[model samples]
Target: MITTIISQTANVRDVQVETIGDRTTIFRSRTWDRLKFEIEYAQQKGTTANSYLIQSDKVALIDPPGESFTKIFLEKLQQHFNLASLDYVIVGHINANRMATLSKILEIAPHIQVIASKPAIKSLKEVFGQYTSQFHTPNHDLDLGQGHRLQFISIPTPRWPDGLATYDNATSILYTDKFFGTHVCSDTLWDEDWKKLDHDRRYYFNCLHSNQTKQVETILEKFSTFKSKYYAPNHGPVIRYSLSRLIYDYRQWCQAQQTKTFSVALFYASAYGSTTILTNAIAQGLEAQGVHPLLINCELATPEEITQVMENVDGFLIGSPTLAGHAPVQIQTALGIILNTATKNKLAGVFGSYGWSGEALDLIEGKLRDANYRFGCNTFRVCFSPKEEDLVKAQQLGSDFAQNLQKSKKNRPLTLPTNNINNLSSDRTEKALNHIIGSLCVVSFKQGEMDKAILTKNISQASFIPPGIMIALTQEQKTELLPEIGTSFVVNILKEGRNLRRYFSPSSINTINSFNELETKRATNDCLIFDQALAYLECTVEQITELGNKWLIYAMVNHGELLANTGITAII
Candidate 1:
């Protein structure tokens, strides 16, 4: 149903209100044409700011959107109810962006008490100072009225430690502030045809929850205990019919991410949410390689957490936005943590968004490079905000870095085979092996949510009877690695001058938007098929053997197609 504007003020502000339940009404402030810049929203989809109004014996307001919707939101609220009648104003979380609108509400409703989680209470005082004395901090629940009671759940993630969700027992609806939300702006009040919204929903999850899998799992488990029938998230359509299915999907996705052995510590501080856009894009790329990303928003993260995560990760990436001419204090503190705690040779990356000068990016790059650290990709610097193309580039760069890390681990002397040159006297067999170069191809596979891939010059037809081919992957010394026998993979043949090999280079692995420049599609076997390649082969591993420094696997071809007849196969 289309939302008709309930109020339009002299300043040309638009606010639409619609009743969803017996006493619950939603005030939506829409921003439909603001998608050209970088943001937390997936695909830069436009968003609607949804604020709820609940009235019973006492009236309560839940989560006011930021200053952008402040004037219209307040105007619409005044038309429906008296300001003095507002008994409580509930804050789901605290951030600098929402302070302006929140302060405006407090000014008009002086007698209204502020309600929030324990952590949010502290932040309220820090931001609002003297005015916060009248706030009410709920331990677990609050009684709004006779039948309209509210229960609170503190769901803390690294990004929002003060996050709170409110449940109304009378209606079985949960006011999920940040959880299970998408940025898409729609006229529909409920998720009626949720199947059609799958892409946007999954994109939102990938951007926000993918890196916070462990925390997501804990929160999902908590949510499972509640008998919530409706999920009224802060943005997008309210979930009713598909709530159970969405929760199940979230659990499965988070489990796959948490089970990955490879991990990267992604440290970033977003001043205007620009840096956050880049961070999300990078994390998405890592996820595709079965590499878990531990994301920390430095502004909200503790020093202890930062130090611990950095020490445990296989690689670390830092991003900051330039304020004036240098990095923010929080980012500087994170940099110190990295220098003091992380290994010197650990793979590192630097990126930043800036308005004028990009000194922050240069500073991070110089510091890490001087310490003899290896960079997974070139330093990323974008002016104002990143565009759609920029986000894709960042993702590919992340994937390339992951592939390089896997290659480096395998090539290390610890994994060298018994027939390695060190074991064999510089013999003719070793020299002959170097001359016998196979076709250069990208082999990728996916099992559940875990994805694994490698760039190799070791693929050749093994037999015609079963239409089989063989691939020799460098052996990994560690037992935690992916690529087990019986796994399925796609072999993408590379054509000359395609430059796909640049992404797999160990010296400078390009992780961001690696696939953006390539023409690709998925095969029947679910492996990626590059349209620019000489040919593509989809196969499943039927047998495996250890062949000097590699795991040789023979696979029966499930599908094959030639993309270009003149496209010469790439050989190393």
Candidate 2:
């Protein structure tokens, strides 16, 4: 049978094939260009789409990448393996982003059995229709000749309900599709430099898994039964050297989420997806205020789920899209459940979007009011698609709800200790750390006789006892000009540095007496201080830790002072 070539190309860099283990080959599609569409790729470190193949008598390919890498990935894959001999395509998780790749795979090799959990099969059928007739829902371990036995674990989370994990009994290699993965691309395959990948891994987990704490924790427990030597994830490097460390980190991260001081159970039903967008904006705001929302789509949720989440959470936010001038029946049902089963004293908020009418918001708010539930913010109504400012307002409304909860007696603060920070335990601490807006400053640097100044906004308070601050520098930075241990420098916090930023950015640092370009003076530490700075800190470098391609400089604040009375610092 002649196979038609069909795949989507992306802004990709290259695709490489390598054999990792016995009968296991990996096709890594790498892109040096950062993804702009997804919030998860905000770091701009670029990414890799990792697809693994295991062959014995039977062959299996696991977790094909999205359309971004689909074209080149398939080409590279065909050059390595005989598609006609392929027996199974094990889908760990299925999403629209990967539909193109899976479709082309089936089109080329029609006899291939697609193995996944029930939900994943459903999703595949929904996307490919009758073509998914070859899909298999694994109920038992599949054995290939020569001891290549595969056990499938259904590790479903709210975000990815079809999340699955595959374990090879013979090789002791576990394939965790999205779990324990980072977005950074590298020349090396194994996590030999896991210390450097810490931030990226934590960032990935925060963006994807933080909100799915209960499910993640339970999955961790389920995975504890398996004895795996190596973890082959869907992104970045494979976990061999840092396998135990990452699993422990996941456990700590999950514990932190469960220990959060406040929780928001968000119930939303959207028609035409307009209300969903508004809900996302609101959730973003809540996250900004350090309150993560447990999102539940009312249409997909069950009555028991509604009761469990509503009864236990510190607060609840309800949103709906008006259908025939009334709330969706699911929304109505959820509202009824909350009104009857939920306590009136619980913090409550409501929002809705409508093209014809917004009576749904009014109905939710009225019912909630009659039930005597305390309102966190006024009901937010949208006529149709929300504007930029409207989204901002929605965010502010979410912030208001979280801020109000902070004042309530039911909520308590969980401060993440700065010192001896080995692992995560306090959820607020992680959230608070991420949310702490740093004041942009032009920091002084010294190497030998050369003096330099560079504008940066990555400064964060690291310790309270010594009043220390941490600054991150890219690994490609001019190390000869960097502040080494015992090197003293001045942090000139910007007052109104928008226009003045040109003096210190794009081409900042390296110039001898760069401060001469601006009005400056010497601090007590003998470092140059900008005259226009809002505040100045004289710091001495104490510790330098390497994180992947970045150098994190931790320094003690020897002396500091506020020069201006104005509290305003950010200049965008």
Candidate 3:
């Protein structure tokens, strides 16, 4: 299933496209929530880009997003089909300015060619070298074998390098380069709420307004004659059902150069200068990274500040200091209000400081996780005083948070690997193995066999033997060691003959004899014996080896199995 995991509050949908035959698959990005956008400065929860996997006779991918998105894209592709078999990756205009990270794609499918316009090729080379090769984009038809052909038309756009639109002849789908598109908080790819579209279009226009007119005109002119069944823009939804209407609207809007302005609110809290330090640092970072982080302090910041910031800001950040064990009551209350009141398009993050235990960070993280807030890492405590190391960590946190926020501004999903059992540690491996064995035992025992009999039989029948009979300590060595409850009897057996053991107690001899007999019987059953008394099992040989003149034998069970489960059962 092509599942869409969106940012908590973002409206920018990410498309995860899978196809059977000429089918277009789209995966939407996850949404971001209040705490993410307002406080943490890393408000955007997940910043994975979107790519459309078009499966015709020749598979084509459109505008593979960022590194994270590409990872997910390739993984999903591998899950469905062989990545090495993929034919072409068409670089759409929308992702021209963004770093495509083609290295990742090449890693999966080295032979696959990345098709883009001349300018896009330059940008791709400049941004990602050695991963992609140059491909021509002419106002001509390029045929992919089996009648699946695409017409590439390049139009220089203000925001991107030589934005190009592709027309799939088979599907009559017009891959728009940002010509007939709008910025809207939409779940559905095509034909969103006009009002929301207007708001987002305004945002896009204001951001792209400087050179948008020329780009829009060029795009409209290039495809003026072509009859399109579907309008797939790089940013927004693909206008499948109503192509002409959306195009007409976009044309009129572009001609008018209409711009809309909105506001954003940034709320934050700080102590010992960590959060406060990072808050400003993040804002500066965002500005540096092409996102505007509105800085606000909840102690003095107003609702109007929040509203104003929210109006224009696509993302927000929240920062705080852990008070007692949770976020400050004021920040929590503000978050509650934002959650109840804010419209979609807002992304948030949680940041804070603590003294020792990360209780507050955990609480905030819980809140974010529970509320489905798409957020970055938690702001955590530094021991007592604010040190240079703490500040540096805080700055790094701010930078990462801002990057995620910037990513959300584009409405990308965060694509991360799903951890499997192979990544577990030795202890966890042991536990898992034991569980599997236990489950097998349970299943086996259900067939009318007693648990004790089965377990004991299995244990006794293993080939590995214990240390008791294998090691023979000298008289001087035995005298130097402290004797435990069972050791004295075993020692006596080592010094005296198996039949002549009256030097110790009669009970001790009987115990040793019983142990020996049981071990022998177990060894005979399966050629393996489990000696539970050994500190470490050796597998060098069946006979004991003398280390430092002390005879030491390899601990083995009769059936060649190692004894890992020790000290759990009685020999009798």
Candidate 4:
């Protein structure tokens, strides 16, 4: 009889590939909701949990999902197959609660046998109860009558306490619990094409791309010897009959990481903006010669952020200004946190300004060296007011640091293409805009109106102005607004009173109502107004371009909202 395979979720699939007389089954389990931690990636929008089943003579179930999904999984398995007796349960990784759940299965099938690696058996006993007789090594194969058998292969994953890969010799299939899988979600089990495969592989490497590269490469090399037809990983889908492509990609990823030599983190604290200027100059100099620098502001750098940057950064540059013979408190706190948590193999440099005693740079440099950080170059110090010579020296220091980075480096930077926004909708546009605004805090607008009195009152009451309102004022109002240019200000509307009356004009009011109606139609159809507005260019009406037309066509290019500025001589 031909065994059937059922795909339940995007990543999870039930495989019933049989060999000889006895039938075996596999189910790929989804461990994570989305592939990566955050939801920025496009492909990981709707990923599911994965698990696998093996129905040899002795029915074996591999790694199961977390506690949240186990009850449903058990019910589904019982509905399809006989559960009176289970012969073996294989523990791929010695995760405590996952394998310990075997006891729950034993409640129904008390005669079940459990198998794992030598170290895994110890871990199981340590975390769960001591069930010695049932626990055995993968060196022994479980026989599934009539020439079908299941074998265990130990692939040491140092990152995990005890990790092993299970092999089904009958179907030439391998069960890699966490290895050889990417954080990609797809309804299709096999990534038959290069595009999907490449995307998943890159995601896998970039996420787990640190110290496990070598271990992953070793596992791939060992598994390449087998004539494998499918790979049912714990997290993602099964690979149907194509192992060479994944192995090739894994090798390339590992080799690339081995060649990455040096990296730097540039942290600056700017109160009067001089530090920002210096930091940008240094970053530009580093980038000109192919050096990667993780630029961060000392005031904004949190412990978690600093720890992440320290993982791969090979050098550090701390920039601050003197505050009463000491570095700024924020900069000092950030540097202190980094120094305490930082690992070895990183260098440090310090630069700052002082009015009196030159103490801030020296103090920062001393703290860094006390933490055993290597010195990149002599600490580049500047006086109370930096001159042309001081700036030039700072630039040279950056160039020299870049040279040092090149000397220690072996790999090229990973290149990812920019995402296209042509087909994006208004809701998604708003979300992206909100994210950008939150991060950069820069707002600009061409035309909008708010009373100057309201603006001034709000600013006086509250420390900061809210975003997205342009105050219309006259030339005489310039003096009142000059102080708030970088903060908030009012701009003069030249044709003021006339422009105000034009907004209420009968013709202008009719045009505005029509535009609002068009907007409503676009929203109902789920079509973008930007596209509809752009379509108007092809209307082909000669009279629309007449110079004496009273209507002014104004496009809010950034927001894609349309407005018309009217005058008798205005062209449509």
Best by TM-score: 2
- Whole-model lDDT, model 1: 0.73
Candidates 1 and 3 compared: the better one by TM-score is 1
Clashing pairs in 2: 196-547, 196-548
Sort by lDDT, best first: 2, 1, 4, 3
Q: Give RMSD to native, each candidate.
A: 21.8, 25.7, 24.8, 25.1
User: For every model shown, what is its TM-score relative to the native structure?
Assistant: 0.62, 0.63, 0.40, 0.45
**Tens-digit lDDT track for model 2 on 463-542?**
64545788888765537435468888887767553355666673345464444667777777766777777667888889
Error of 2 at 34 (Å): 2.8
lDDT of each: 0.73, 0.75, 0.46, 0.51
Model 2's alpha-carbon lDDT is 0.75
Backbone clash total for model 1 is: 15
Question: Per-residue lDDT tens digits of candidate 3, residues 1-572?
Answer: 43554543554434444332355565433222221222222423332234566666777777765543445555665666676777887877524223544667666677777787776676567756665453445546767656668888876642344677788777777777555554332345555445445555554443343224545666677787777777766555566655665557557655554232222234676544456655544444343444434456665445455444454555556666776765664565455334433433355666555676646666555544444456654544555545555555655655666666556556544522312311221222122121111010100001112111111111111121121123333433323321222221111101111222221222111222333333322222222222332111112234434467554332232112213322111111
Off by over 4 Å in 1: 1-14, 34-36, 39-45, 118-123, 269-278, 285-290, 298-308, 320-345, 353-367, 381-572
Q: For candidate 1, lDDT tens digit of each residue in 1-572?
A: 23464321232336668887658888877666453344355465567778888898888899998887888788878988787678888989877658888888888877888888787798788877777777878765667676778988888876677788888887888898888887877567789989988888887787778899888889888888889889988878889999999998899889878778778988999777688878888888888897898889887777678877875677889999998777876786577546545665468898879999888888778667654578888888788878889898888888887887777566544333323522343222221111112357777666465444557766655654445777665555111122565666777767666787665532222222555566567878766676766567778888878777767777887666556533334655
What candidate 3 gets wrong by more than 4 Å, as runs, is 1-21, 29-49, 94-100, 127-139, 182-187, 192-196, 258-572
Q: Which portions of model 2 show Cα errors greater than 4 Å?
A: 1-12, 269-288, 297-302, 319-330, 351-366, 369-374, 377-398, 408-572
Instruction: Output the lDDT of residue 538, model 4.
Output: 8
